[model samples]
Target: MPGGTDSKSGRIGAITTGTREAGRLPVLFLHGVGSDKSVWMPQLAHFGGDRMAIAADYPGYGDSDFVEGATRADYARAMLGLLDRLEVDRVVVCGLSLGGIIALEMALFAPERIAGLVIANSFARHPEGEAIYDRSVAGARDMGMAALAKARAPMLLGKDPPEGLAEEVIEVMSAIPPEAYVLGAEAVWRADLTQHLHRIACPALVLCGSEDAVTPPQLSDELAAALPSARREDIAGAGHLSNAERAEAFNLSVDAFLSDLDEKP
Candidate 1:
């Protein structure tokens, strides 16, 4: 919504920017649960040069098509469809939280389509994901999305998060359909990509907020440790929503990593 045009009802929704260049890989963004394409505005602005940059909304989360009971695989397939529609041969996929897990699935399912990866504030899987999701689904079932958004938004930021960020996050999250919320929680809760990390052959960057309470630094440390070609960076004073809380730092770190990859022979 912020980086590109939104679909006029009934059309599939995606935020796309930059001019497509032959032989140049696009930068594709996948956002976390309760978030949509708009969250990647900072990244799109930073990366949308001559190369393609896109931030897409998952089904039921935005203007995208809704598929009840969607799995992570479904999300990955949707991404593939987006790429195909855009004539993109390959992409540098970047994802945050639930989006990050989805990125891993994309690597597992279609490794050839990905040139590089960025996993931020995410884990292979949550150890107590079952209980966490159960409570979450139940809460949504009872209180509704607005209430859930208001309740959950605070836990995702640092002691003093970026101004206006919480409100923005809540607004996006509150718009999610109940079914999609339930389905998303289940998919993330069930994900276990530990064994598959070795299969991700592309260069990867792992990021975490030093103050992140949702997915702590230890989780990112483990992911960085497991990835074959990877580096870890921590953003001080940021929390679960690191990109939003510290957009300048996050963008700089990612830009440096992508620039380094561009220099490769």
Candidate 2:
């Protein structure tokens, strides 16, 4: 798929397919700190067959232009701005890790604009937030993104990942600019959205990989319990990047959730 830039909205870059159909909300896929829009190829392909499916590159990642000292709010606003440019009134957001946090922020920022949410391998409030941010930034600053990717890629996958999966992860993470990685890490790890979860009343599907040591299933449990209308689903034997590790299962869960949404009058 080709990438297009919305220069008016912080240069948000996105790859989209399919057409907007009546009564069907568009699905927007957001990538994690260590990934770009390409990680959602499987999802875009599957969902695009029936309705509009979009995967966006956050500012400072992939084809999007960089933003100096960007915060989570800034990222959320950029996405909303993109929606405005696209003339989309409402959407269903599917996000993982860093992307999940941004998705929550977007819902809180504009509850009326969001139809539903699919949050995977993420947390409302990380237990060791400061420590994780400090360590990640230090590693990125010291070893650079390439070396950091080589070291962290394995930790992001399950005990037994598919062939070349780790190498694919390393390749993707290595391509991220060190500065962008550091900036994204700070935004993701330092965020605390616990108090605001109640404000997002949209239906939500909270997913976590059974083998995810990064955010862990416990975090998803807490997130589901906190959200007003949310449920939890676990991707068996998968890790932090469950969508990539188990695309078929992830898509099935999301499809079922969207199907339920469509049934609502």
Candidate 3:
């Protein structure tokens, strides 16, 4: 919940964010590892102006200066800080990949304030593959961005990725300090929210790209089923970063979900 000049507790750093003021609910966008709020550009364009939607970079990513002593908890704090700054009492949150995990953490930390949620391409518990985290740290340490991107960039995109986005992803990730990116990956692999799903009281949406080999649709289904108030959707022909790869269809699903929310009266 960070903001401009008049913060009470402190600052959440120079966060990069996108906003739309006309929609019913304020929407907060959270990006995944090694990426920034810009990842949601297409969705922002689709939903902006008429929708109160926002996308923000985590402290260390994008144009924001990195916060020292950073951890996932710090990420949540920073988002809450923004909410405080914006004078928003409640919001619908949407997040993909690592961003989804942060959104979940926000719900857990402040259930009373979250109106709804859309969690995509994420998991309650990371499946097997200790080696993925280990290798991420190693590759970042030794060979730098190219090596890490070579290892990671393929699985993140669909079978046939968009024309220029691969390079775009690589460029963003390449800007990250190798050690820092490794820290983020380790945080993702170490994440565990298995016991916390039942506590999420806000209305929620769970979705995954049909082609997401990372967390997969099964994980989304599991989360949806476990939640007291959650609906799950699957997007065809998209992968881990489905929101970016197939933004239009993804936005349609999101727009429909939000539309349903608007009709609740």
Candidate 4:
């Protein structure tokens, strides 16, 4: 098991584990809008054994302070600021959903600082983004986080989720402040990174859960097709939250990607 050290710097908070290995870039895990750094426990434990692994909470999500009217670029800057504070030069970014958009923004802002990218269950430009933003904000405002989380948890998971998984997702989502949730939803659903995809000149692994109705596999396909150097892999029988729903498969794909990175000259 990986023991994490939780720390805060400026407006960013993160859970870090393991030690930096020479010639190997650190791995930074960014959570989706509905989750915090805690959602990455599976990944942190799996990857923290021999290399630096850090999972960050977006501003307003966990220990980090809220940023009112934060744009997608602003979120990207916040992550970069966290890296600067930690004195980490470059990293392999692994992100899901909202986290994936921020990763793209970071690459666009500072390509030299991004060693590679692992984008899962995300989109360069969502087709139903506006409607999603409207529905989500309305749900958060009306039903409240707890109720909304309870209602959506089942949809976010596969037909047969692991025991306690739905409860975990509901718990995590329920804790998010309504104001913060709205901000994150806006930042995620209102942005478009389609034209900018070709600019991210790093190795990328695009992952999609076969049962992901949220972002859908078609979105991942488009992402891989647009990115300069990227490949697509589908996690069978998994849903939107594949990282948690099918952790073993998700970690295996990530492990293989990391191994390839290590083998590079």
Tell me the whole-model lDDT of each prediction, alpha carbons only: 0.84, 0.90, 0.77, 0.88
What are the candidates' C-alpha RMSDs? 2.9, 1.4, 2.9, 2.4
How do these models rank on TM-score, best leading?
2, 4, 1, 3
Higher-lDDT candidate of 2 and 3:
2
Look at candidate 4 and tell me the lDDT of residue 200: 93
TM-score of each: 0.93, 0.97, 0.90, 0.95
Candidate 4: residue pairs that collide: none
How would you encode candidate 2's per-residue C-alpha lDDT over 31-87 as one tens digit per residue?
A: 999999999988999999989999998889998988888888888988888888777
Q: Which candidate is the best by TM-score?
A: 2
By lDDT, who's the top model here?
A: 2
What TM-score does structure 3 among the candidates reach? 0.90
| Model 4 lDDT per residue over 136-183, tens place | 999999999999999989889888788999999999999999998998
Model 4, stretches more than 4 Å misplaced? Answer: 1-10, 263-265
Position 20, candidate 1: lDDT: 68
Query: What is candidate 3's local distance difference test score?
Result: 0.77
Off by over 4 Å in 2: 1-9, 263-265
Candidate 3 stretches with Cα past 4 Å from truth are 1-23, 263-265
- Which of candidates 3 and 4 is the stronger one according to lDDT? 4
